[model samples]
Target: MQPLIDEARTFPARAAAHGVNLGPHTTSATPQAMFIACSDAHVVPALITGSRPGDLYELRTYGGRISPYTEHEPTSEAQTIEHAVDVLCVTDIIVCGHSRCGVIDALHPDSEAAPFHLAAGHWHTLMQFDALSAYPCVQARLSDRTLRLHAWFYDIDAGTTARYDPRASTFLPL
Candidate 1:
């Protein structure tokens, strides 16, 4: 915690030297995508995608799970998606799952350290995309061809990424 605090103390100075003009960005931020990933510290969307500040609107959840939309149930996940879609007008939505995910293993103990666990991770990514489709904001944007939903898999060991190809019903090299 002290290290983090020390870094925060110098952030103002270092950020200024980073050469990004933050003045204009102070008013409104228009990010390129809505990145939905697990809360796991290893699954860093920004570092994985080489995105800087204001490049991605991130929503992190346990296992990156998004609840199925139900009008009666108001969830922060849904609200985040609505804001990212309606207000930010982000064109892309990425659901990323990582290798050897503890959440995935905990949820499915039978598949622990097995091939099924790996498959489950990929399945989970696509499931999030399906969940997002249930959101009216996402559906509206998708219907108008203004939004695209993507499912990604990140191998922690190899540091390689794969994207789901709905046509092939499989993950392919990104």
Candidate 2:
């Protein structure tokens, strides 16, 4: 805890160096892409894409799951999509899932059941299904037509990536 607290103390220094290190991003930020990735600390969009600040609008989820866009009620997924498309006018939206995901394994029938925090349980419920389907809930959400949604598999071990081809229903080397 002390170590983390010590790291937190560097915030001001980092903030002060923002203009020096991130000077190019000093202007208004209007990202051209919306990156929906896993919340895992291992996966950082800026680091992975070699992008600096304000280049990408990111939404990180436990399983990098995408909720379908709907007009019924105000939802975080809906709001994020609307803002990214209408407000930011982002051209592309990427949904990336990482390898060896505990969340995905938890949803697997063969995997052992373990207690998760309330938020994790709720997020899992969004992907839980009553019937056996080839694709997960997130895949189903990407099937929507309004926005061009892409699913990617990021392998941390091999440092390789694969993109899901919905038409082929497979992950191809990227």
Candidate 3:
């Protein structure tokens, strides 16, 4: 914690040295995409995507699970998804799951998938997509073919990402 505090204290100088100017990052954000990942600290959307400050709007959930959208009783996840789709008008949505995640293990303890492997995380990633698609805003954008949804798996140990290919019905290296 002390190290983190020290890093934060020196971030301004480091950011300036790295040519990261914060002046243009206004309060309003128009991100290119909405990235949903696990709440695990190891899975950082910005770092994983090499994204600048506001390039990605992020929503994190345990095991990257998205609660099904209930029209009569909307959840915070639904509201955030609505804002990203309808207000921000983001063109893409990505749901990412990472290896070595305890969330996945707890969600499916009976599964035969090797513990903490990317394959073990596949089920939940797809489940999140299924829930995300149930959102009205996502449905509208998808119906108009103006928005794209992607499921990705990250190997924590290897520092590599894989994207699910609908055509192949398999996860492929990205």
Candidate 4:
């Protein structure tokens, strides 16, 4: 905590030296991309994309899950998506899942592990596949061609990345 505090204390000066001016973005944020990623400490979207502060509107969830958007019961994930699309008018939405994901393992058919002790509401939102189809915002945007959606898989151990190909129905190395 002390080390982190020390770093925070000196960050302003270092940021200024690097020409990272926050004045323009202080009033409003206008990120072109909405990055939906897992809540894994190892996955850093800014680092992965080499993006500065206002480049991405990030929405992180446990296992990168995209919960269904119900009119009566909208999840925070849905709200984030709506804000990014409707308000920010983001052009691209990237759903990034990584290898050895805990959520994927939990949902695996072959796994005989005990039920996860997640909240009851969260447990109900968990599904095996078709995450993009389940998301209302994603479907609407894609159909209208107003936004492009990308599904990416990061191989944590292999240090490689793959993109889902709909025609091939498989992930191809990027």
Q: Per-candidate TM vs. native?
A: 0.91, 0.63, 0.90, 0.79
- Evaluate model 2: give its lDDT: 0.60
Candidate 2 regions with alpha-carbon error over 4 angstroms: 1-28, 109-148, 166-169
Reference-based TM-score, model 3: 0.90
Q: Once model 1 is optimally superposed onto the true structure by TM-score, how far is the C-alpha of residue 10 displaced, in angstroms?
A: 1.8
Give the clashing residue pairs of candidate 3, or none. Answer: none
* Local lDDT at 34 for model 1: 93
Model 2 residue 142 lDDT score: 41
Deviation in Å, model 1, residue 59 alpha carbon: 0.3
Of the pair 1 and 4, which is ahead by lDDT? Answer: 1
Name the candidate, 1 or 2, with the larger lDDT value: 1
On residues 97-146, what C-alpha lDDT tens digit does candidate 2 reach at each position? 67656675666535344333323433343232111112233334345544
Worst 10 residues of 3 by lDDT: 111-120
Which candidate, 1 or 2, would have the higher TM-score against the true structure? 1
Give the per-residue lDDT of model 4 (tens digit) for 120-171: 2133222312565566666787789998877777767786767777798666
Candidates in order have lDDT scores of 0.88, 0.60, 0.87, 0.72
Question: Residue-pair clashes per candidate, as listed?
Answer: 0, 0, 0, 0
